[model samples]
Target: MLTNRRSTMPMKHVRMPSWHAGSKTTTSALPTYTIDNTPKSLTPAILTSTTQSLPGYTTTRLIGAIHGTASLTHKVPKSFMKSLSGSFTGSWGEPKPLTQVLYQARDQAIERMTKDAIEKGANAVIGLQIRETEVMGCIVVSVSATACLVEKERRGVKRDSAQENPF
Candidate 1:
């Protein structure tokens, strides 16, 4: 003969890491619609990869987090566009030649961000980052940064963050 037995157990709540305590997963609410179907030329102005901060200066006040985004379709040559029938109509494989176009779009996004920073009276933007994605054969780029007004501090003067001077 055999008997069945059951044991009682209590469940414990697990906590998430501090980093992920506050996070939003939804892609921004920006309109996905494009104004002009035709792709435009792009130029990179002050979007250097090492633009985390202005050289010889440190951020004082953070104006706010600024963002700019741009979307561009593959500039298929006239010959290819004719074969595809006008603008791309659906999701499809991309041509390697389109890489340059994608870069142009990314640069355009950075340009817009730089303009926004300037308009806010910010001399430079810090922590700037660029992200890209492919959607329906269109390359979408987004630039994000903290607009800041930085002042060049005297190298000899030490920051006041220290409670006591070692010297």
Candidate 2:
């Protein structure tokens, strides 16, 4: 016959090693990242496009060539990596996470380029070229443009409109 025994010793707090601790994990909810299209250093007066000249403006003087570059790595946010894995299996649609990262990088590059042009005393940027490249699991955006001074073209008044305007 065996007799049950009990100990009167008080229990001490014990800590267990957590596998989840120290390991980066991604949750189902995507990270909130706001992309600001407008930059403090850039303004609407500064025109940018992939063309030789601005439509309603004339390039008076070509200041110089200005370039801006920005890059984002795959590991920027661990959540993106996880989302990317699952994103590949979905139907044809926009990749919100990846697109947001790219847009952020592009916007930053554009802002930098415009700032550079503004420093050079250029009112507008023409022949703008934006290139996107992937390097070593990173997305790189490069923007180049010819900074120039542009003046708005004056539209000649028609004969009827001119006669209507009495000086």
Candidate 3:
């Protein structure tokens, strides 16, 4: 028969490794939201290009492929006011609310893709592609690119005859 008894030995605290520290779950405060007034083209810290390669920079290493996507919905209004404004603005007319929504979605997708590239230690994203799809009332935008490291190509200066013969 075993008797119920508490161990009198001192308890030792075990130190966890650095990698194991993040295994514990913790509650965090919700992030604060703010309006971003900066232009989308100027927002990314990493260089992005639609072409296979950057114009003036050479790829040092390819990190990997990354992707991002976003979706938004807007009801298209058929009203006399819109037609009147469209008529005054000529054949092309003013941008529709739907178009604006699509643009916002595209910007958000690209921003997310850029953030992914940054997190992966990439300095640039090449072969960037943005695809838009309209499903029901929602417009979804997807962005894809290859994250890579790039360096500017160094060009040797052309020496003129006068400079070469300078006394």
Candidate 4:
């Protein structure tokens, strides 16, 4: 014969899994949106590493200088505006702070440019310059680098070596 068993205590509630905590899920808070600064007539091309090796010549590569610029407009998101009356202290209808946004943009632009130069076989970058501008409620950033190729002379074997004989 079999006997039935019953519990006197109630069951506990289990919490549901959160998407934010999972690595498989993506978050909406991306750092910086890309705004192409390339001129309309100019097309940016990727320089391949194989191209760095010149035919019939050994060479050393170096970067001459790097230049960059960043510009941003403060849109004053609705969420930010809503918090202004509570936590933020400033002019009533003023836009977001330009300094902070521009700084972030500038840093990101510079990093991108440096990485690109490195990928193109550049050894070093010098004399960096940055510029920023705001136009029609949008930010524009520009960066440029000058690259150089150098070669070292190889030493030839001395003629006297031929006179020596090995036992």
- Which one is best on TM-score? 2
lDDT tens per residue, model 2, 1-167: 22335755655535434665645454433434546622223233478868888897867789999999999765556567776666677587655566666666787898899999999999888888889998888888999999999988789934365656443
User: Of models 2 and 3, which has the larger TM-score?
Assistant: 2
> What is the per-residue lDDT of model 3 for residues 100-151, given as tens digits with 9 covering 90 to 100?
4456667789899999999999999999988988789787899999999999
Residue 72 in model 1: lDDT: 77
Candidate 1, residues 15-71, lDDT tens digits: the string is 445568354333221112236534445644542334666777766777888888999
All-Cα superposition RMSD per candidate: 18.8, 10.2, 17.0, 15.7
TM-scores for all predictions: 0.52, 0.64, 0.57, 0.40
Clashes of 3: 0
Cα RMSD, model 2:
10.2
Quote the RMSD, in angstroms, for model 1.
18.8
Candidate 2 vs candidate 3: which has greater lDDT?
A: 2
Q: Which portions of model 2 show Cα errors greater than 4 Å? A: 1-45, 157-167
Query: What C-alpha lDDT, on a 0 to 100 scale, does residue 59 get in candidate 4?
Result: 38
Which whole-number lDDT from 0 to 100 does residue 164 have in model 4? Answer: 62
Residue 62, candidate 4: Cα error in Å is 3.8
Ten-residue region with minimum lDDT total, candidate 1: 24-33
Query: lDDT per residue, candidate 4, 10-114, as tens digits?
Result: 555344356536533232222223355211222223331314344433335565554445566566555434534443465454323333345567666776766
Preferred candidate (lDDT higher): 3 or 4: 3
